[model samples]
Target: MKITVTEDQAPLDYDQDQVAQQYQEAKQQLWRSRIEEPSLMRLIGDLRGKRVIDAACGEGYFTRRLRQAGAAEVVGFDISERMIELARSQEAHDPLGIAYRVEDARTVVPQQSFDLVVSAWLLVHAQTREELQEFCDGIASRLRPGGRFVTLTTNPDVYFFRPRPDYRKYGFEMTLAEHVKGGAPIRFTMHLEKADLEIVNYYLPLTEYQEAFRRAGFRDFQLHPLHLAPDPAGRDDRADWEDFLKNPIMILFDCVKAE
Candidate 1:
């Protein structure tokens, strides 16, 4: 069955300066620092001399990391101009030779192919399978033959199969409609220290994600589980992370463009 997106299900905008700043702060949350970032960087191993694109690179967080990882060239793109402004400001303050641009991931026109393309929390915004396909296709277009695409996105299973408030302990909660299905809106509320941040993401079934990657000339599409980074303090916290580990809210998607 085809799922139709209503106006209320539209993707949230991060164009406002306040929204962009809040989002940047949200990225520093514990779960991201320990799980999401390490997991993604592990998947994108050895960036030395590689040309990379950080698609939907809000505030150039990962973009700067990519350059620091020794990527020969790195370009970051985000749909929000304010986000780009923040990224550019950082670039000015600390020159990493990274380029920032404002572009929608789904319709990005690739000027040149890259060795790798990484995006975090980008695909979940697709309101429909068609838009998801477009986003996949655009990512594929930006990669050279045999280049990889890695993204961190909402775990469909966590939303459709196990919607719960347990994640609130980890500083976020997902509110879902009683009748969940493809394209259903997912209200994600992040409990920050100062304020709560809410964003909308659409649920696309695993099969739909497979189809989108297959149709976009990608092969060996894989879903990778999150991994927690070692504690900097060397203190054991497995007990505290058990709930989150059992039901991870975000996961990594990895694939390679056909050579």
Candidate 2:
């Protein structure tokens, strides 16, 4: 007997459950490490008691952190329902009152503005600069006058220069150049582990990011360098650590609305 395969099958869209699981595993591997916690905690220290909007609060990793930092109110938004479900589950046990919702960061209109709006690695998955700009504008709109907005993104310099073996000889349908240049409006692809193997990430040009903040009404902006260690262990080699420190890896933009 011969079996026939159906042609009506459809490809699955983005799976929130799978994405949540990926985030859970990824955060455990990345954020749970001690090497990066100090920098993250130090950043959160200044946000204490502020009403915060966590624009892309995946799995509530940083949302819980914000609560621990004493944020008066923390509202989290994400496009993934499963992630939001997990976040909500996490919030139920917290002494701090944190709220998590499934919503698109691209179309954010908060009922009330916040004192600080913070997002981590949001633009990594976005397909266009326009999406990035819109995300920034959404954050700006959700902030009170003189409110602060911050984001952490991979540095483009590290990305565009890195070579991808998968694309080179594997016969991947699209080349890096085509992925970046062929898409309408010009887009970039995340090389993921191939580029920054340890972490799944994407990059945006430093200059373009600076200008994006300016366009979004952030009067002052700054990009701080983030250096990563190889073994997830504290750097013992001062020179290697120093070299990574000197090299641009990721950018953390801290800004405040001008108007």
Candidate 3:
């Protein structure tokens, strides 16, 4: 029922059944272990009384987190059916009232729908600049005049294709065949349960994102580059955390719609 991705193949270049269990479990584990996840939470800020849409919400983790953080309303959606199924199932049992739907983030961007919109590592899927624009347009469309959209992304500066001591220290590797400015195929090798698996991503340049955000009517940007500064209160204490500071992994970006 599952197909595996070969070395010659793109990562996660498999059928839905694979993601149904194996890939998802690995991703979820990595989500907790990685430095980027906690950094994402810090970027999110206080959610009290805000209406949030968790675009590309995989497994509804953040959706429920948002609701628990006292968000006035929270809705989540994903393009993958299996991811949505897991999200909905979690919601049914936990009863967080977080709505989950199977829809691409670019579509169903209802006008003035939310006060804040967030996605976790969702921008890397835009393999083309045009697709990035459309995705930002959808995000902008869903926001009210003063709404903000935020997401975590791979640092465009780090050519993931090359080896990094930091990556190895963290127990995984990232590689790409070549560097393409606008978009390029990238892959993440995740080590889970002592086995290695790879997942595909796209290298989206910050410049491209700036242009897309501009076209989407976003007038301001706040990007938090990890590793430059230490958050005194941050709890993630991986052995390679210092190594992460040197090589840098990812960043969180926030863009605001003009009033």
Structural similarity to truth (TM-score) of each candidate: 0.93, 0.72, 0.85
Task: Assess the local accuracy of residue 37 in candidate 2 as a C-alpha lDDT between 0 and 100.
Answer: 45
TM-score, model 3 to reference: 0.85
Model 2 stretches astray by more than 4 angstroms:
1-14, 30-32, 108-111, 160-203, 227-248
Query: Each candidate's lDDT (Cα)?
Result: 0.85, 0.60, 0.74
For candidate 2, what is the TM-score? 0.72
Compose the digit string of candidate 2's lDDT tens values, residues 128-203. Answer: 5686788777777788888887776555654354442232111111122333321112122222322211223334
Backbone collisions counted per model: 0, 1, 1
Report lDDT (Cα) of residue 198, candidate 2.
Answer: 21
- Give the better candidate number (1 or 2) by TM-score: 1
- Judging by lDDT against the true structure, name the best candidate: 1
The number of the candidate with the highest TM-score is 1
Task: Point out where model 3 deviates above 4 Å.
Answer: 1-15, 27-34, 160-163, 227-239
Q: Where is model 1 more than 4 Å wrong at Cα?
A: 1-9, 108-111, 160-165
Question: For candidate 1, what's the RMSD?
Answer: 4.1
lDDT of 1 by residue, 91-144 (tens): 999999999999988884664579999999899888688899999988988899
What count of clashes does model 3 give? 1
Candidate 1, clashing residue pairs? Answer: none
